[model samples]
Target: MFLGDASTLLSVLNRRLPELGLVRYVCTETSWIESVLFWTDIRVGTSEIVLLQSNITVNYIKRKSDYVHEPISRTGLESIWRKMIELEILAMAFNPYEGMMAKISPTATPFPYRADNLWKIQSYVEDTRYGEKYFDGNFERSVEIKTRVGSGNFFRNEHSFPVKPYFNGQISKIASF
Candidate 1:
């Protein structure tokens, strides 16, 4: 999975996205875009436009603390926000008391979040195909990662992330090869 940002990746997905129907798997906490649209308070407007650009256009919207929504669960969350192709997706991660981050109250004055809009998740799936997630948006490619970062961070050059590879003790195994 080449990870970059949202817009950059969505552009690619729009270019030649795979053809597949789906079922969705997602955590209750993975309701980021939900708050943005449904919450009204977090809706994208003039000021919030930068948030959209950062979260989607740049692809920095991988996680709340600069992580990807893959390693935690296999919830097919993307399907929720946008009209997906009806593929079976599994989305996992923290909805609340499980993960490192905490869900913020909509009315909190100094809204604490890593990004302009916080959409935190660990992992998700599409049908049987899986996406082992992480917090940083470092997928197999740059375009996908960039789309989440959005245009604001992209233009301002603030789009960057530290990715902790899920080594799974393979490092020592690879040395023997």
Candidate 2:
């Protein structure tokens, strides 16, 4: 899904995250794209004030001489993961939907420090091969680490957040490296 914001998000991740070993082995399949779409409401306690959010899925592929292969690398995939967190953190304050910074309410009140959009991870998987169960663990870890560091704004400009264990749910379903 080539939404208007897709390219912009991809660029941010590539430049900021770079190649690190943060990619979980779970996403090491051949180059693939995951599209995550959802809606979020910025509410006042329980009242819905406004709805705004973004869905970004990353495509992981290996880099070769003047060519890119679908086989994902640990470094390449990790970079994508790092980028996702970075984008989400920015999303808290910036509203891609409106092409402006996010507001605290629909009244156009400027958010103190960019509104923190309440987000949830639905799933990240290779739809062609396996179902939601395949990437469940890795997706969980990704959101956990992102939310943890985002909560503190830790190293916000860089992808240096800590990571947890590998998620290999039903190893039989994943493609071999």
Candidate 3:
């Protein structure tokens, strides 16, 4: 459930409280919701918790999501279908931001690209070992091309803490997540 570098955490804990004998232990890769559910089950002495833990498997995935302001035309849909067929990847579109999403104020959340969105288009491209050269392998390139063709320009706002330029004279955005 610890969503960070385990070694860094261990080092800090060891420096602060060496007497506690805190050694790093690797936990199964579970989502935050799953971890909370498992913890609750364990706390209540649920009999099926052990079985659930045994079934946990770490999934490696690459996902790109973008909001659409307008509905896609028939030709646009055809283009997307053709691209998916050519690349052998999957793309899905859904409208989950109609009712409640529209009601919420834009300033209410850090996610600024929520309001006035018609639907969301998501692409799932797995980063596999064998296919690491073309198609889904080059995730950034593939996404850039596909998104440009489908939804004009992708709008991914950089949400990072501003930092001074490095010794190499290149400014880097430190990810605060």
Return the clash pairs for model 3, or none: none
lDDT of 3 by residue, 77-156 (tens): 88877776666443353545655577788899986666778767665433322234544557445534443343222233
Top candidate when judged by lDDT against the true structure: 3
TM-scores of the candidates are 0.18, 0.18, 0.39
**Can you write out model 1's per-residue Cα lDDT over 1-177, one digit (the tens) per residue?**
223344554555556654432112321222445544433333433355566575331122233233432342335444442322233222233333211334444366464543333354443222112231543433434434443333245435433431211222111100000
**Top TM-score: which candidate number?**
3
Point out where model 1 deviates above 4 Å: 1-61, 64-91, 97-109, 112-164, 167-177
| Angstrom error at residue 160, model 2 | 46
What is candidate 2's local distance difference test score? 0.34
**TM-score computed on alpha carbons, candidate 3:** 0.39
lDDT of 2 at 75: 100
Q: How high is the lDDT of residue 135 in model 1?
A: 32
Residue 94's C-alpha lDDT in candidate 1? 36
Question: What lDDT does model 3 reach?
Answer: 0.49
